[model samples]
Target: MPRLIWPLLAALLLGACASKPEESPERTEAAQYREAQSAMDANNYLTAIDRLKELEARFPYGRYAEQAQLDLIYAHFRSQEYPETVVAAQRFMRSYPAHPSLDYALYMRGLANFYMERSFFDSFMTTDKSARDLTSATDAFEDFERLVTRFPDSDYAPDARTRMVFIRNEMARHELHVARYYARRGAYIAAINRAQYVVQHYQRTPLVPEALAVMTAGYERLDQPELAAKSRRVLQENYPDSEYLDDDGQVDLAWWPREGKGLMSLLTFDLL
Candidate 1:
């Protein structure tokens, strides 16, 4: 009898505790946010975006408004709606400049730009990104640089640094490709300038050896054997067994940029 009475009392307390007050606006707003987050977790990004936008609109200055705005950015990003993601990320940055999650907003902003430029077309194009215009990639580089500079210790900084490395390499390769084009066209001086840009500005990239090789080739064409020899020495010293070098450690002219394969290389770079 005592056990039955205790069980009944516990049930009554649990039911009272589970009972809620009338649905308040704040309560509704919180519920909406939870639902949106659940949708995001389920990979229903479109649904998450819709719910988040509603939360932001209905509770403009509400407790969850700013959070909703931030969530909207991620939802859009996950959906591959890069432009919308940037808009929402920018809005989040502006709305909460000092928010603890500000690093994430900046990372997402940069990531949006990164994805905007990383189209499927890249996989099929020549290695030459020069003519297609990489405004988005450049913008992403700047954004990632800022994130690294400001939030060096943040969790996202590591990924931002990795992205920066890739962007730097691609940009360096862009300059080298232009240099190769000029070298192929008998524009030795222009080729030298572009190659020098790669050597000086992008010294850490794989293209540095190629840049040195271009410099050697360009100087040879310009009838500057002294400078050509100097470039050859530097190339040999730094990249002794560089793929751009032959068994004799001389520049392998055959390694020069291909004449008409920028698009093909662009598409096949990662695949191959």
Candidate 2:
């Protein structure tokens, strides 16, 4: 009731009235998600990624947290950050195995790995992708295979199937490339083993005939006449018109581009 006490009370009331109220957790989460979604709709993936990461951090157990994680994978992929895309996708899969979008996460992980070795300059270069190290391609193939096998009815299954085929072919071709490399270097046993890997694992691939040819040549060089005859017989039976076979039924490896130009370059992976 004192005059000085009344003034202090009035000041306190004014301060309380001017202070901002804290937003409810649910409302805050929803608003942040909306902002991220709007950025994505506008094709601002960088902004979306930032907002999505912040949402996940602030609302770790919030209702929109899982969805934010899922969007982070896609936004990283769209931004061409392949490694981050893979990490985000894999994290989502591990965090929410029972989520309805699990198939999407697997598919995106596969896609991210599939393009891991490629760069923007690849589009303008004529590099032989199959001849390069195919570790990422192999990983992508397994990811796609798992998706197709576990969620065959998922909307992503069809595309995963298609990518699986391409990866399989690339793997088979990579094995064949290694086989030819060993064969060219007169490492007969190594060449035969590599070629047989392709034959045993990639039965339906187009490169099977070439693998058989490598095996035949390698066996002949190793003085394994019976094995060479067996490989040649199989090639004749299954792929009589294969380009690797000459008119005399011999294994002709003259078609390799690197063989004609320089042996050192072929072995050094173009380091020359």
For each candidate, the alpha-carbon lDDT, in order, equals 0.85, 0.87
Cα RMSD of predicted structure 2: 5.1
Predicted candidate 2 versus true structure: per-residue lDDT over 1-272, tens digit per residue: 59899999999999998896966666488898999999999999999999998898898999998889989999999999999999999899888889989999999999999999886789698677778888899899999999999999999999999988888888998888787777666567888899899999999889899888888877777789999999999998899898888899887767333334477767786445
State the lDDT at 197 in candidate 2: 95
lDDT of 1 by residue, 1-272 (tens): 99899999999999998895756555488898999999999999999988988887788988888778888888899899999999988888887899999999999999999879666776577455555567888989999999999999999999999999998988887887778677665678999999999999988888898889889878877889999999999999988988878888777877455445556566875233
- Ten contiguous residues with the weakest lDDT in model 1: 255-264
TM-score of each: 0.78, 0.81
> Candidate 1: global Cα-lDDT?
0.85
**What is the Cα-based lDDT of residue 261 in candidate 2?**
41
Best lDDT among the predictions, by candidate number: 2
Clashing pairs in 1: 123-267, 124-267, 125-262, 125-263, 126-262, 126-263, 127-262
| Number of the predicted model whose TM-score against the real structure is largest | 2
